[model samples]
Target: MSFTVLMYHEFRKRGDIDATSPSTISVEQQYQDALPKVLFSYIDDFKEQMMYLKTEGYHTLTLQEIKDFYEKGTQFPEKSVLLTIDDAFQSVYQYAYPILKELQFHAVSFVVLGWLSNEREYFDPSISKVMSKQELEEMLDVVELGNHTTHLHKRYPDGTSEMQATSLQELKKDLAECGEYVTYPDVFAYPFGIYAPKDIERLAETGIKYAFTTVPGVNTASTSVLELHRDTVTLGCTLENFKTIVEKGASK
Candidate 1:
């Protein structure tokens, strides 16, 4: 069987949802899909999953480590799982980062530079605040940072994919900005989990060694290096569901 690579998004503590916060208010108003139930995760659930991995004897691997196994025949420890989070949510520092450090596991965050802010980059009052520079510097102890593009996470009104919207120039430029901002490995987790075949060519031109997608499956040596799949952990995921994701993926 192949090893797993888990994907996660924003996280919120079970007891700490401030109903009156601008970020909360903004989602409560404009974006129906922004409900906390689906968009953010409970901190307790994250802890329990990590605990399961520990007690069950899973080895946490970074994307690079996994890549080595796939591309160069390097061997990883048994029950290897690569953990990744996208969107650079500030909640990661408060929730996932501490738990990962405490558990002595490693994770990677694919940061969308557009999401950073003094408070946050989006919303009227900027609600969904991403990690600050100081906090990110500290979080490096537990997490690696990768590119998630600068501003391609958002969708156009016509609903065309951002990477496919232009003549490949804008796509390269967006990735360039990400390279300039997010420093570390030359990995990329596609924004919006959407891409075209041409996008693969574009990625190579920009020094991207690996890319992640929203697809579900355990990655083996046969899996494509640029379009590797990941198991998504969401707010609704129970331990059983999480286990299935780690084992069988979202669909059988």
Candidate 2:
């Protein structure tokens, strides 16, 4: 059976930004400029999308379920979808976690270990603060952590990701380092959805079993676990658009 995977990043809540201080004013300005960007989704819109999934009988697949689908040739319902949030943003813990918890939906949060802040803040748009380890721990009931890498979640001046620019050995080391902070290290979403064919061939050496990309499509038992596709849900994704995305690649 085929199933779709959805990707998300930072979330924003209206009226939640208190632009009182100079830092906050700058934060508010940055947020306003980023509103139309693909990576930022309004929290209310995100909630509506999750609600749609629940009402439409979409089952949020877990890590083990994905492993079975890849390794054991298992089949799951067509309505099954995997929800993933990248970057481990504090906004995810702030805005997305509550909605997922309330809906009893499970999601995977891919984190860059090097970027996690030691301190937690209620809101900080300027830094777009990463969640602290404490915040991540508290969401264990509804969120599973995945490795996005340790310090390689960046792009070079030439537009290649650090993942693409570095050698496989270095990449392996980074992945292992990130594993120390997370419960699951076998799954990864490519930094900037970047990788080379040789990189994929050697990913097994790093112990990554399943890897996701920005490429949009659905996955089936026959699909390669290392090259999984995901539909990125973004700022302007309407409810109708969401339905079309989730329904587009279902098995007949």
> Whose TM-score is greatest here?
2
Model 2: per-residue lDDT, tens digit, 1-252? 888899998787755443332221112111211222467777888999998889988889998888987778777777888999987778888889999999999999998888776667676765466777788889999999898989887766576777877788898899999988776898989988888787788787889999999899988877888899999886767999999999876667
My TM-score estimates for the predictions, one after another, are 0.83, 0.88
- What is the Cα-based TM-score of model 2? 0.88
- Model 1, position 45, has a per-residue lDDT of 87
Off by over 4 Å in 2: 15-36
Q: List the residue pairs that clash in candidate 2.
A: none
Q: How close is candidate 1 to the true structure, as a TM-score?
A: 0.83
Encode model 1's per-residue lDDT on 1-252: one tens digit a residue: 367788887777665555433243222112212324455567888899999988877888876676577667887776778898877666777778889999999998888776565443332223455666566667887888888877676555575566667566777788888778665547888766787788888888777888999887877777887998887786657999888777552112
